[model samples]
Target: MWLYITIGLVALLIGIAIGFFIARKYMENYLKNNPPINEQMLKVMMTQMGQKPSQKKINQMMQQINKLQKK
Candidate 1:
């Protein structure tokens, strides 16, 4: 019946919402523990580009990256 179909749809939606939240939380935690890029990687990239990355520059870049991720 139509009532059964409605209940099934509702259940499916609830499952999807729960899954989304769970996945989002997991990714946030993973990113916090292991950032996408680290200071070493940044230095490597800068060196590759023929630029010596200073500590201040690295910290600035890290702050910017963190801000972006938070947004």
Candidate 2:
């Protein structure tokens, strides 16, 4: 009886571990394929704000965005 109970518990743990890893990997791939934003969107936003964006400014903003996302 005790052997059966131990085996069931171990199986449950293995399932949980597999599920966690699969979900983690899927999220990582999703984020990699579809980031939250890009340069063109930033440029459009700045243009809408009535400021012509320079490449330097755009690059700076991109760095800031990437830094924030890392946190």
lDDT of 1 by residue, 1-71 (tens): 99999999999999999999999999999999999899999999999999989999999999999999889
Which residue ranges in model 1 land beyond 4 Å of their true spot? none
Model 2: how far residue 29 lies from native, Å = 0.5
The parts of candidate 2 lying over 4 Å away from their true place are 40-53, 67-71
Best by TM-score: 1
lDDT for model 1: 0.97
lDDT of 2 at 35: 80
Where does the lowest 10-residue lDDT sum fall in candidate 2?
28-37
User: If scored against the real structure, what TM-score would every candidate get?
Assistant: 0.84, 0.64
For candidate 2, give the lDDT of residue 13: 100
Which ten contiguous residues of candidate 1 have the minimum total lDDT? Answer: 30-39
